[model samples]
Target: MLTGIVEIVPGVSLLKGRLSSHETTQMLQAEGLAESDLIPGKYEGILLLKAGAEVHFQDYNQEVLRALTAPNVAANTAASGQHAEGCTLRRPRYFAGDWTGLPCLLEKEGLLATYDVILSAETVYNLDSQRHLLKCIKQGLRPKVGQAWIAAKSYYFGVGGGTASFIQLVDRDGTFEVKAVDVIDDGASNKREILLLSFKA
Candidate 1:
């Protein structure tokens, strides 16, 4: 039974499926394939398949050869039992030069419920500002989460150091401590990296 979205087709991710044997038979019947059209090939009985279910999924295609000897004769190496969401993937990248360009992204994604990323003297949970952080992320403001998420430039730091480091994010969502968007040698000092994001108070 196909419960969710995303079913992998031979070429691309298919957006349909998960019908049962009777359902497939009905569909085929509607398509003009009769009960007699379903003959004994390899599968023992008639062919009854589902919509979202796949070729070897339930093995009721009614193509006898498929039902009876398909399994032992054929081998499918594709990942099984996994549902794909296809084009339903989420886009998580946004940017803007100032705070004025933040709110739209937040409102569009409807993420004004929780979360925050800003600067202040008090603890985040106690702050009184809904700076609209999610908006910033939608406007192409990619935030490097975790230890650090910054936007700096390429400038030799001190003497013998790696690329210039500036931004950092501390979200403990188990994915990243930080992610770097852009790098500038002294971007932060010159206000070159001046994108700020925060949540509701």
Candidate 2:
């Protein structure tokens, strides 16, 4: 989700543009991320968060977090006659780091292989990073009961990574069962799919 300031405004388009002038892009270029959105072992397409600067996806992230933490907020409000604001909630922990090594680090911190459900969106656009991403999921996701939901296009035209390719990888790995939970074929964009990966029984 390469969001921008406009994302904070209501009714704004969620379409993303190239990061031509963003400071993060410049910094990545300086660090040798020439033109590609991703460069393995060097830069992955994450924006650097600056102190005192509002993150582009902050609002969306907060909304999602709140929904996850208080899914019954509306029901509670109607039943108890209390407003949503009165409900006390504990926030989930947020972590940011390179995807390549994050799983190993979290494992050392006793956080790996603990998640029941993992979600990833639009991450399979680059062929180079898919293996690393899969590795991270394999390491962090709980065995047997854990599952990962990946949303990606059926075919990424230029970068050569997509749901089909990813499923092939998973099949070759032989550790997970891949299933297409949903498919989106709007005719305006590339065919997209939501894939579910779970450990083999």
lDDT of the candidates, in the order given: 0.30, 0.60
lDDT of 2 by residue, 1-201 (tens): 233322322222123323444744554555323443442222111111111111121111222323221232222223332323333322334444447867766778797888777778888877777888889889888888989999999998888999999999999989899999999999998899999999999
Candidate 2's clash total is: 0
| TM-score leader | 2
Give the alpha carbon lDDT tens digit for every residue of 1-201 in model 1. 423333244423322225577965765665323433343222221111112222221211334333333332222222342224332222122232223444454457564322323221111111111122222333332234312123322332343212222122233223233343443445345322322332212
RMSD of each: 22.1, 10.1
Off by over 4 Å in 2: 1-88
> What TM-score does candidate 1 get on C-alpha atoms?
0.18
